[model samples]
Target: MNDRENLCLLHSKDLLDQKRLFLLFKRLAGQHSVSIAKNIHETIKEFNSATFTEDQKLFEDLYKIAATIENKVIDVDVLKQGVNKLLDNRKTIPQPKPEDLCVNDSVFQNKILSKENNQKTAPVPAVYDMLSLLYLTTNEKQRQQHFHDLTKYYYRQLKDHLKQLSIELDEILPLPVYEKKIKDFIPNAKLEVILHYLNQDAKEDTFTSELIQELYLYVLYPKINIEDCFKIAKEVVGIDYNFLSYELVEANGLLGALGQYYKLKLTINKAGDDVVLNLFAKFMIDFPKDAFPGGEDAFPKVGDAFPKDEPPTLSLQEEFVYTIFVPELKNIGLGNICDFLPRCYFMRSSDVMVFEDLTYSDYEAVNSEEPYSYEMLLLVVKKLAKMHACSLLYEEITSKGSGETTKINVQFSKYVMGFSQAVDTKFKDTIHYCNVNTTVNYVYNQFPDVAKEITMEEFRERSRDIFDSMLDKMKTSGKYRNVICHGDIWGGNILFKFEGTRPVDCSLVDYQMIRYCPPAQDLMAFLYINTDKNTRTNYLSKLINDYYTEMSTIFKRYSFDLSTVYPYEVFMDSCEYMKSYAVCQAAAYYPSSLDRKKVQDLLGSIEKTVRFFAVDKTEVLKVLMKHDWIRSRFREIVEDLYDLCLQK
Candidate 1:
């Protein structure tokens, strides 16, 4: 076919497809609307003579029917008729005697009567009156006019409310008024129609449908008069609805799970534009009490499980990084790295940390297995050097009492050196699982005969011993000199900004594990967790040299001798000593670092750490075996640790 003919044929096919889709949607919408109308009618008929005892069952049935109608488009006329019939039946039912009324009914009656006395004597038509006028009228033109007028009324009500709140309405543009009239109105009209239609009826079905439709419209169309709904809601409930806007985006629950995660996007209007905020909220409301195989509690309190005076809480550590460490880094002319850290706006009710999103700023997080180029690695190493140098300078400045400084007391060693009972438990469980699992066997089988000579048991024992020594070293401010180490320096924690394929800048995050430890802890963690076997083998020396050189330059700028503070020899020794710990961390975290899917799955799991190891073990083991450089590195570390154990 000719190019013009092919283009014409494609356009015709697209048009036909769109028409088919529109017809299908229209048919489905009509069927759903009729179904919902019938269900509403049946429910109301069944509940017409229902006693107070059957009220709960009536609402439950209505709730199920309402849930089915969600996301389905309905005919306005059918919905109006169903609602009016229900309302008429509700009015015909005999009212309960004063003595027969429940406590809730009596309280509601008194509250309404008191409200009526305080307000104006003139009776206003309820929302049902407006909906009936819009729907039942025979003139299509009049119905359309009524819909437009009703929308304008709601917007005016929102404006009045805003004015009452002492907000300047002139500065804040009202929906439908500020934007293109026809374009904005079309999308928002459906929600305004639904809300006005469903408002006066107090039935569970009506209220739920209204709420669901409002939430749907609020998210899909930003120009909806959501503030008016909030105002009306507050007046009806007699309590302050202080929040601006909240809409749930994702929700998942597992049976018998201790926790649940809810992802929500909130809209807060400040200045002129709306600021959309994304939040992931976790609730640890339930506990199994005897979840473990031996009838031990899975979730234990710090005081019950550990003897530490101060437990390392994620909130406390994050707050410290936000309020203290970030400012210090910026002060030392290392603002580039600080830009990567998630800006904590505030801690809401202790558990929720509202962070300024970097995704919107074009900073993308690299996935697991996405190879970091030399330039990208260089950028990260330079930032790490600046951060470490700043830490040294901060300590020196604080000691001299030249200005206000945060008291450094929460050492990384105190938290990681068997101090956190949770970490200690996870460590034991992970090692035990690795020792017994076939995944490890598969990995060992792939290694050379010489490497395989070290039995799994011996490997396990050597790993444990190395971890102990490393912990002891981490706990003390030893001869190697301590600086602020990004306790969790993995691929997942690092975010990079790129100009096409080239990395321009980088940032470090997840500061809950921040600790005062040897800088090698951060360096090794990054190398082992981020780099492939080949990259590590080829560039490890150069990277280390560059890191020391950058650190030296930064120290000199701050008027401190790099040798007196942290010498090149000491840094190398620390890296060598911490090699075993790096390998162990790599084994534990490598699976999660490989992909976003793994990270999300791990986050959602009940036994997060255990489940992460179980799911990722085989994948990580395969990576370790397949890559010659990685396999060699692992074998070398194991042998070095084994020799040291033998010497001891």
Candidate 2:
């Protein structure tokens, strides 16, 4: 009757809680804002009275959606006409006052409905149908989560409730309407609920209950409208009808066939609802482009569309992600992509590889106790330097476009975060790969030798200070217009196009973890991940030399003074400060070599630095004095970090 009571429907949970349910129904359905319809309260009450049992929120969310539909219209007459229909429909349903329900379930009435066991108690039996449609239309992840949330408490109660309503059909209604009405309420229920409710001999029960009759009517007398069926599919069920040139299941969004991919509970929906797939297309997720013969970097600018030479069945999505018809892995069409450059075999998903043209044992030796070769190490260093070069001059690289692309990218970060909760336990429960808690601790532990190395009590403060200092430097370099860099430049994407040891070109894939930061952040992280403590010590001098040579070459073309831009001392200082990234990466990625591709990807980075170079304490001081990039402002940061530990 009043506004406050109407809002209470949202808080009400039980079907028997008539007053609260109707009140919430009125508030949710009557208007877009809280304004009431002329007879909103009366209509809801009537609907509750006539319906076999009451369902509050389900009716309300549907009516609310319809009302939302009506409100978007500009014409008041049209809106009123729509509202009048909803009201009339509710009146046709029976209403049960609050006194009619089971009194003991008050607390239950205030909680949310169990979607699995929820009853469709509205007078219009179609109300239940609409609710089912809503459930079907929800995305797979959300649907699963809701399904999971409801499985424990109320599933059996909803099942039993359907049983009781079937028995009283004849006693409650006229003969002609009795059988039909009961069937409409609990159509297609299992036999036990029916026999128990009817309590009649199976032979004597020739006439089905109204709920059963509705099931038979639906099955034997199906609604037959071909055009309308498609509309029902696309609009009510949320299926897209767009067709690609080939059935690339990965890119196609396989409706529910994801059971076919790498195993997990993650099902690709053919439409938004049923896991049942249509014959026209195979629902999938490993993007067709990901499996294309070339890596994303090597894919030719305009010509890399799926090759037409193959018959309809062998598109890249089907060929790579699932199965292929090729004679061997090599014949699977990398040659079809480009013939000149040697492509390394690596799976970004599971980085296992064996190449037809590989010469160096180092690439294949990803499994060796020593994972890298001298030539492979050189390639890894060169790539790190190149990744840094991109970030160092991001604006100049992107200057050509109205807004040209820079290297920094984190489009996949959101997906990575989402995977922690929704993806399988294999990923979410991973100790190293996605453990945020482990990562923070790892960063806290590295460089403990320094006095006051950011106490645990002071971690947040230290992190803020470190990031602020780094950003401050970034602002001055290229004047706060730094190039975007790959935030996670670990060995996952460090392997290259090589004829064994002779690396033809370096390519980076899995752009999912990209970010913008100082150029040296990636370089330091590469050192941390690729080399051990021993190797880091041995190669610090040579590594520094390699980076300087590559960086200086890039800087010379841009007319910046390499000596002044990122000087040797500044690079070492950046390493000391940024080395925490290695700790974070190790915690997230270390123990996860379970998959072949993942192991190869990680070891590929490690191969660069596994040569066991010993650290020399004296070299650090000599390099600091000789290099000029460490500006006067940065002296305190280097001094504080250098004091953390002396090389043995």
Per-prediction backbone clash count:
1, 45
Candidate 2 yields a Cα-based lDDT of 0.33
Location of the lowest summed lDDT over 10 successive residues in candidate 1: 99-108
Give the alpha carbon lDDT tens digit for every residue of 307-334 in model 1. Answer: 2323334344555667666776677565
Taking every candidate in turn, the Cα RMSD to the unseen true structure, in Å, is 17.7, 22.6
Task: List model 2 lDDT by residue over 1-648, tens digit each.
Answer: 465433232211122232433333333332211111112233334333222123443333323333333213223344334434434544564464321221111111111122223543322222232222222222222222332222211222322332343422122222223222222322212121222223322222222232232222233222211111222233323544321111112212111101111111111245344343121111122323333223343222323222222211112222232222112212422222122122322121221111222223232214212434445566666765654564444433343343754333232221212211222223212222223433233333433433354454455345434433432332213322233344444454454655644655554432333334556555665665454445556775677678778778766766656676567776666555556544444333332311233333333321111210111112222333233322221232322233322211
lDDT of 1 at 382: 86
Work out the TM-score per prediction: 0.54, 0.32
Candidate 1 local distance difference test against the native: 0.47
Q: Pairs clashing in candidate 1? A: 368-594
